[model samples]
Target: MKNQEVADLLREIAEYLEITDVPFKPRAYQRAALVIETLAEPIEDIWKAGKLEDIPSVGEGIAKKIAEYLEKGKSAYLKKLKKELPIDADALLSVGGLGPKKVKILYKTLNIKNIEDLKKAAEQKKIRNIEGFGEKTENTILEGITFLQKTENRISLGFALPLAESLKDQLLASKRVHTAEIAGSLRRSKETIGDIDLLAASDNPKRAVEAFLTIAAPKALLGKGEKKCSVILTSGMQVDLRIVKREEFGAALQYFTGSKSHNIALRNKAIKKGYKLNEYGLFKRNKRIAGGTEDSIYKKLGMAFIPPEMRENLGEIQLAEKGSIPPLVKLKDIKGDFHTHTIYSDGRASIEEMIKKAESLGYSFIGISDHFGHLRIANAMDEQRIKKQWKEINAVQKKHPKIKIVKGAEVNINKDGSLDIPPAVLRSLDYAIISVHTNFKMGKQEMTKRICDAMEHENILVLGHPTGGMIGERKPYEVDFDEVVLAAKQHNIALEINSQSKRMDLASPLAKAAIEQGCRVSINTDAHYPDSLEFMRFGVGIARRAWAGKADIINAKELKQKS
Candidate 1:
């Protein structure tokens, strides 16, 4: 979908508007950009339906700009704004904490136009002398720059997966294309993708390649041949497309959808069996066999089919050979989400709206776990507000009796192993998720004790975003996860796998450790908006990577009332 493309343009416009001292227009554009990002359908589809103005927070002006972008693949006003500013505004804003205001200040004060310039300034200690930036801010900028350098080429799975799916859909539309599938790290469901790899089966390779090239609209055609083509998209993602005959499709898919180690292990197994395995087919004594399907190929090698996510060569092959691979959790296995927020706290959607969205997704129950009083910045619910929220939830329960709505709060864990909310208030709710939102710099022993104490609270049900990492932007806070897992097991508190794209905390490895340590895991979106609920798939992917089964996840079962 062109949703991300349009959102990027709108955000760029917002940044430029902020630099130009425009009143309120920048915020309007920013809000519109956020709304566009969360939209399920393509922005072009909305424009085609003549209902761009129907989108929330998008008015006439932004609608016109979006229409221009969809029709021409560029916005004239955005171009004009870029030309006027004449700086690498996007590059400057790529730093974690560097907002448009900071970008403007850097540009005006030190003539910093890009990351290189900013890095040089920070290294020279010039930024600390600026009006608002001090030594601490300078050090943070340097750290952000380092982080940006490390992750600049790596795109998150959440962003790359949709783009790859769209490309596959476009390729499948062609009459010449028989079947198309994404391969490489994408198929393996890696957290970050380096590039997109696609494979298609077709009778006419040339025709399929032509159709792919036309749809891709490459900024630069890297190469082209009768059976293979490589191109760089305008969005700077490289895609490699290859077309093979139907007979070779499965072999080709298995060969390409690989971790190097997995393929090598499979090849060794094939060699021991006096067979040769490659992209074309598996061969014994130069006679082709077992290339028509992945299942057939695995059967010929005397092993069960290994799921792509488990093909990380992390003992999966041995398990497959032994026929003991456990069933990984699937999206359909989840009965409901135990961790979610609403308009009562930091969430954008109201309680009714969240419940309705969950019902639409076939969930039988959902918990409204909003922020508690400690997260003052989120405008958290106090005693009175909590009572009002429960009253509203009761009203909704009467109206929507088919789905269960559990009232809960995401109570903050204080530094000295105490919960931010009173025990009485916590006990009054259905359950509570005790989380650490601040004081991330606490020492390992202190942090472990704090989390363990929170887990001891009778009202605490789950530990939310266990590690408090923001992917590439921020490092996970220091804590002895082994001790934390032991405590969770002892206290019967579930550790959460937060599915927000930015913070997939309690990441796959940690989740796997918790499961192995006999602590049940909760896979939650920690969704603040209705659209964010869809992020559950990413969480499921992490769980699969962790080799977590349905029974290992708490939310996979029907909701039961706490004693």
Candidate 2:
């Protein structure tokens, strides 16, 4: 199991312990789980090195449990807890705003075993009758249920991408498989995907299919055939695999890796040219033509090769036809990350650690944009602490002359369109990233004005997480995005595409709009831990989906030169 999976299991154990009224151990487990999740090295590796207790917050008891979990597939303590609770803890906790205490109340009072039971209770008005749950709470529960149902079939890109890669690797290892690739929405880099689609080029389709089944050992076989196979993984993710001859692989890939609208557009183009386009191959007057490669297929259609991310029927076809499709920003285009946190704020790693991580990633520069003092919950830095951080950053700069360290703060935007940091202090930093941390209920006009006013500040270089959204959990705050985009253009401030999995803010659509408005974007991980900096790839994905090229992103250029 992966470190993240182990961490999640431990976290679930903590939740179940809390619900069961276990004292002290629940909080201990919680702390250990957090450390495990953020650890740079795998917990299993630590255990193999016989240093399980070396992990912070992990003590003898927790270490033993972790060892048991890693050695076997399950933890004895966790299994015992599950047997005692006899409730679907994950399902109960999946409800938005529902915590261990709430789940306990529901389980003990209403006999709510899972989501279905909770939904029934809410619908029958039984939830309101419970001591703490009012009519408002009941309605909120219903809304959360509806949201869960809507997103149940979909998995976040971050979650699905790695699994797809692992599957592709397994397929490619088979002697019968010549080439393998993940397709569908995943290939398009969609933020969320319903299922994983895999395509392989192989001469022996039956052997390839059998090898996949043997390696995957899926929980259930949904279907099986020489050309196509479907299965449900142990993690409950559905996967579909298709194998085709090397000669027809390109056409099959194009057919399957489709946004329905994009495929329809291509078919229409083919019809106009008196040709036929399908999964088998592109045909002209019953003669097989180009099908061996994606480039060949596009060439046959007399168009430039459109990137999968741009194949959403969003004017990409026209651009391809005219051979004017701009180059999309690649992960390598990012020279630095302008928004990151360290121990000065709510971040887990120290400034030196973050800089080292960035340097290891081959970054020429990195920014330490920790939270400013206004965010009390994060224990954000005050003026004195900010100056102290700059001192430390300067020292690090001297030590690591190869990586330019940009000193900055993520200043909170107050309700009245004012910044939390004083103007003089903000100006002292190399640059400032302004963001909204609270007052999300402001009307569209108020929010827009608040952001626009912040952008007007001389020190602000980028607006972080411009939409103030947490995908699948919270909706974007009300704001006139057009006004914000225009303001960003006017003030020469870049809008950020936050790379945090939960908040891919300035989401692709808004990022595209910002680019069209002559506003550049800053792709930042908004990373709290050094490891989180790797999320930059997700930000780049969003930029590509927005059709943003290197020139459209500020961080793609050297910050020192711009300064």
Candidate 3:
């Protein structure tokens, strides 16, 4: 973990303290912690080097606290916090739609401090009776807790990808194992994964299975056996492993790498061929046969091997019938990003650092579009601040001749379905990206009008994440795509494909619809930090799935002249 991660944890501790009514000191510590996290230097190194005061947020008071923590291997403040607040305060907050206030109420009013306590309170109907808490909220909290317990708590695709790779490495290292690879939704590159699947092959299945179970576990083991093993990591993700013979490896890999619908279709294909297929192997005439290679099975079914990414059953089979599938888009094809934020708003990185990071990745241009007025929590700037920012941007552009910095704003779509900034103010920007940030209650027609009103403005260049939904958090306001896309086409406004792992907003179908409507696409990493630019993979994956080409995406070379 990095110092920033620790800093974030400290902030959470502060929030919990505020809710628990711990004191003002904890909030100060939390603020200082966030400041330290945003600093480029390593906190541990600074403490060891006796230079705590050099950190921007570490003043005399924080310096003393750091000294105590470094010397004693703990902080007195944190110790007090842990004693006063429950250790699982953050876990309780993870319950969908539950805030710190509610968690605090459960702890203080009902003596509920952990999941077990909360569940017990809910079961006894104690939570619903609390002041400010009602039956509906209680049921929602209970459902959230159950959902969190049942599913692997979500992690970024970047975080999960390495675990899958590492497990494959460990399994393949065994002498008996002939092949090992990751399968399941992960192989298909879904934006979110439920559980990771591992498929392995060996000449002696028993030895391979035994070896797999005996492998050292970095995370807590949930189950261990011959054919399969399941484990839950410290981060709360579950992984499953399956072993098969070398000949059956390909079929097993494909079977395990299914989006259920895709697998069902494949099974139907096999059925039509008078054969049976499954994760274990393929069979013919009620007898095991051709269970080894994926290519062989596909050949038997009169089809070529399909890429894992194209297995979403989104016309992939029909395209395969024509012996054609769109070429996969790669990270290299991305030439710029549009919807990035900086310290001007609620971003961890600065404009210089953000532009440098993108330039380092060989991007020719980057748009610095921080939040516009109305997102007070994010310190969103009004016209004056944005105008001042343009001066700084122009200077940076002059200094870094290799890259172009497009001055932009993520203008809020206010409650009345209007851009937070006036039209005259928006026109001053080199580019303007209209986004839905609040007032999501409006139904399809109203929501469509709300976004279309902004896109209709000639100066607005892009629509950022048209539907403001966060997976598992909020559902997007329903909208008329015909109106939204058509308005974008008429006004020559590009639609954004936000590359955030959590919000691959322009899903393939929507992006495809945008393309058909003659609306250009921008695959942007709404990157708040330098590290977030790496999320471009998910965006590119979705674009390829949507049958988009270089000409279709505004950040690709074909669209460079316009940029």
Candidate 4:
């Protein structure tokens, strides 16, 4: 397990202990464990690197524990906690408002252990009569239990992407496999993926299935088959694998890797051409036929090849037929990021730290567009604070003359859709990224008008994360994006492809429409730390899917200018 994961488990145990009235000592252990977990490097890495003392969280006591784990493979304290604490650490979190201390009472006194036992106790009214468990608490626990059971296990696209890439390597190495590629939500770069789907071409589907089954690591084999198999990883992520003959590769790939809407559109298009489409292969009426490649399939339909990002039935087919498909943007074409946060805001890294990290990643310039005063909780700055930040960023720039530092702000667009900062102040900066932070409940017309008002601000060069939704938590504001994009183009404001893993906002189709309407894009990492700058790939990926090109992005030529 990763060091952070181990720490998170320890924290959960501590929370449970707090609720259960477990001895005070357990809390200390949990605290130390959390500290160890949040360190930039893990205790194991520190020990391996011979820099154990250098880690901020590794005090002498924790350092000794690290050494023990390194030498003994397990901690004595961890074992003891598990043996004594009968309560399921994670289940304690299910009881709303009743934390670790209360959890111990339920476990030790009421004999409640897991969610099942807790639910039984609640159903029987055994929990309500308990000393600390009130009627309200009982209801909350039951609701939480139901929510947990109904909740589907999902993984972020960022985490699943790497895993899919690793598995693709393994599949490609298999003797029977001729071609393998990651597909489905993963290929489309969805913000959150349901499961990973991999498609492979081979002569021996049996051998391919066997090879997939034989490979092992922290995975629960969901099932096995000649054509398809599913497995749940230790991280609770599901992955599916499908294999087919080389002749059917293209058709199978297109069919299996799909958004249902996209597939239906493609199928309908094929029907118009007198061809039938399915997972196995494409057929003309009842006769079996073949399209050797994706290009051939598109050519057969009398259309230009469509990139996977444009696969969604959002005028892509029509655009391709009219020879007006937007050119896809690439990672290499991005010259700079217009919206990144640093220690000046809620960011974990300092200005110099973020600059060096961006430089290492081959970027020519990076903007420090931290939150403005409207988001004080995020350490948003006022004018004076921003002036101080400018001094710091300027000093760093002098030392690294090759990389430019653009001073900017992620200024809040208020409830009525007005820029939080005045135009005079906004114009003083090199650039501005206006974003909505509140009043997301507005009607579509109001929301569109609100954003349009912000776009009217001449100094606002980009709209940061146009959709203010966080995956699984909030729905995006109701806005007429077509009108918003039109307004943006009129004002020459670029739309942002936010690179934060949780937000990958301005999704492909919306971005595609924006580009089609002549509104340029500015792909950015709304980075809060140096390491997060790397997440620019997610934004770039969304832009590529939207068919954004070098000419469509503001910073695409800035790096070349520096060179």
Highest TM-score, which number?
A: 1
User: What's the CA error at residue 506 for candidate 1, in Å?
Assistant: 2.8
Q: Rate the local accuracy (lDDT) of all candidates.
A: 0.87, 0.86, 0.75, 0.75
**In model 3, where is the ten-residue run with the lowest total lDDT?**
1-10
The residue pairs in collision within model 3 are 247-292, 248-291, 248-292
For each candidate, how many residue pairs have backbone atoms clashing (under 3 Å)? 0, 0, 3, 12
Worst 10 residues of 2 by lDDT: 34-43
Off by over 4 Å in 4: 1-154, 173-176, 203-207, 214-219, 264-277, 282-292, 321-324, 382-384, 414-425, 438-458, 478-487, 559-563
Off by over 4 Å in 2: 1-4, 18-72, 126-133, 374-377, 561-563
Q: Clashing pairs in model 1?
A: none
How much lDDT does candidate 2 score?
A: 0.86
The residue-level lDDT of candidate 3 at 308 comes to 81
lDDT of 1: 0.87
TM-score of each: 0.94, 0.90, 0.78, 0.74
Model 1, 186-302: lDDT tens per residue?
A: 888777788999999999999999999998888899999999999998778899999998988889999999988999999999999899999988999888888877878998888
Higher-lDDT candidate of 1 and 3: 1
